[model samples]
Target: MSFADQADRTLEILALTPGWHRLRDLRPDCDDETVAAIVLEAANFAEGVLAPLNPVGDRLGARVVEGRVKTPQGFADAFRQYAEAGWLGMDVPEKFGGQAVPLTLHAACAPLFERGCVALMMAAGSTRAAAHLLAEVADQDTANEWVPKLATGEWAATICISEPEAGSDVGRLRTRAEQRDGEWVVTGQKIWISFGDHDMTSRIGHCLLARTNDQPGTRGISLFLVPNEIDGRSNGVSVDRIEEKMGLHGSPTCAMRFDGARGILLGKEGRGLPHLFTMIELMRLLTGCQGLGLASAAADVAEDYARERRQGGRPDQPPVPISSHPDVARQLHELRSTTEILRAAILELATTMDIARLEPQSGLDDFTGWMLPLIKNFGAETGFNVAGAAIQVLGGVGYTRDWPLEQYLRDARIMTIYEGTTGMQALDFLTRRLWRDEGRGLAIFLQKARDEIDAYATEHPGASEAALAALDEFERLSAGMISMRDDDPDGALYRADAYMRAAWSVVSVWMALRLSETNAVAGLAAQFAFHSARCA
Candidate 1:
């Protein structure tokens, strides 16, 4: 935590603010107070133990021997420490010896681990995500038998969908699954399987997808839980190779080859595409934090550097810290402001998921169905920008291994590419979320923003002109979007991302507004709103 420059004000802003556990408050059905405590404690441990290891991990990288991957020197020890703390089961069901913590709290703290080292975060990430999807789709016996071990970290898990040719076009996946001896045999080559193999866990299950000859396109595929180890044998699976990655080196990405690996059917046959979509949803939400968490770390690092480092000199004048430099301050400010918004956005969506889980019929559930990817895409992309700014603030040193920015950059690069790439996200936002069913979801989100503006305007007539203009422009642009839907799809969707930006800004600021209503920070809320409005 060397500080060439740092921002006391920025730190004060982050530290003094109280984070609302919105889900617990809004939805009583999904109580997670205990879960929050567990998540925060683990987050603190991760920050203390794992964050310190990241620079070393990046320098050391994961070793690939033969076809097996070994994490950086200390990662094994740290992973043991992590599991010893019972961090793995936080999100799994209580029946499976998991905490079954509310999604919001888990979402809240998941970022801290990623911030420590995103590569390593990806290791268990897909497991939990895929496992949760299994809980949704698999039979009770399957969940009972596998979830406990998976949650306890006795087994690792992964999602297998992408191949050499089938990425964004999930429908094009050519992996084949055929029934044999009352079980399915899977044969496919999957790339980018994070933590595809590790010596730390004995059992590895892959939530795999392949063609089943029932239907063509995505419907032809079904999800199967393929165990990598059975009776100490290969289980018809092989690690073809590990990816030589740019960052998150502590976590190895593998290309896996399945030679008729025996797997249990997950969920229903031919429902794999939709069932697997749930896993994608979960991963997208979690991966949203990946980029944001890493960017937040970069911001924290830059802020610390700025506050303490004295660069420019004056003969008679006292040396000013780098934070005193206007450009540095601006970078820190942008990073903090946008990060604040990003955190707010993610938290909002997290709470939405929690509420959905609690009250299945609550509008939040349907809203989350569409909004999850939107928030994920928004958070990560902004996070990339924030991490880049943090790097710029660090200058040449940022590009070197001597500092964390290069690792941050390498980590950020994958965020835009993985889970779902930025392009897919944009397409999802415009076509699936925004215009789907004539844009009901987007309209709901917009109404929420409008309600905030209306409430704030009524309560505080002195609301800044900036806020008002931003609100007005938001309304205008939204109208433009609606008007163009019938006449110009491209023009309309071109601004879909812009609309997303505006919506994120307004909603984030509104959160600060609504939150400050109880926190006695009306001025800060107004400032957040002003910054949000600047997106227009």
Candidate 2:
């Protein structure tokens, strides 16, 4: 089946009505049919242009030739087509050459793009995040100049956060910027800068963080915008080398050097880390969307192959496809059901964000804030697991380079490690979301889950029991952690991964239960039952 068909059907099965209604309430001019048309167009472009280039990009990754980073074959052209098609500006504002569409609409189309080529999408993803941050926080004059170009894909942008010695520990970074003749001159070496030095665009804008004072940790850090070119001349920014990676090779992971580069200060001084977090949050959400797309793509490939590959049969009858086998069927069902649940959850999350933007004090803000880490960490792990299951369905052939399953597995592996690792996500969830607020966010989510379960129980008592039991387990697990606060202060944190899993299992099953009403026979009940049994 085509990606368009898959996306449409998934949206239908998941019943996007609540999210759509919320979005429409915010933007009255937005129409569902128009969004659907755009999604179909995106799917066609993904299959026709991006999908064909996936293997080509993987085979011939990005390279630095004579100080300039060059992307794989067809990358530049495909990106141009992607930009011209208005995808870059779809969710951006009309003031900046964007369509100003609701984010929920964009969320629906994300998987199709990632399904086509995840590597290629990374560059665009970073740029889109950069554009969003600029729009939100940059000085109006500076933003007006840069946002339009980024929105139209006429310029690309990158986030420079990691250094050789400082990956997750941004406070330890040694890069420095000094005020000289009314300009900030930056000098530093940054590693793991995705799309850091690509020739796909004439100019690249970098959102860099550097120290300006002697204050320790993140206090002295300030954000800077370093252009790839200045006044028709090369900026001090240069690509030292591109890292060879396990996957997503087409997107450059550059080691960059800044030697007295002219920097435009972004936001206020000494507040760089906080401002840059806007970009990080946006990137993490996009990364989650990427995971969803890849997992769905993996399932697509697996199901297609399984339905055709004959395995066993009676002597007089034709051999049945491997999909007829119980175990293989189970894997496919898990993959499909998990992907659909994640989709619904992500869209709901997006709707919350859309609402929060207009009404910051609204209770939805807390949910949006709390959902980011889970969406990113769980989404990434789900993609990885589903991709591996896809390989299992294909048996030996899936492990070989002859098929794309191996590539999918390799590409999906990095999602958990980058954009902040899963461990980091768990820490944030436990400490920031739960501990610091004293369970404010957790209480909200649990209350919402309870309400849903009560509504569901009225119709399907058996499924409702399973759902309530899962929620009960979550509460018990959380209570045990909370009880250890004084004597076993670090115990809850040490078991943060377990907590994350438990919470996700409950929330995901809740989402599945909601979706089951529309897709009652889609085996979601069985899926939730299995998960609830495990939670027990």
Q: Which candidate should be chosen as best, given TM-score against the real structure?
A: 2
Q: Per-residue error at 2 for model 2, in Å?
A: 1.9
**TM-scores, all models, native as reference:** 0.88, 0.96
Per-residue lDDT of 122 in model 1: 78
Runs of candidate 2 with Cα error greater than 4 angstroms are 517-536
Clashing pairs in 2: none
Once superposed on the true structure, which residue ranges of model 1 sit more than 4 Å away at CA? 1-22, 25-40, 313-315, 458-472, 482-486, 490-496, 511-536
lDDT of 2 by residue, 209-241 (tens): 999998999999999999989877988999888
Worst 10 residues of 1 by lDDT: 2-11
Candidate 2, after superposition: displacement of residue 142 in Å?
A: 1.3
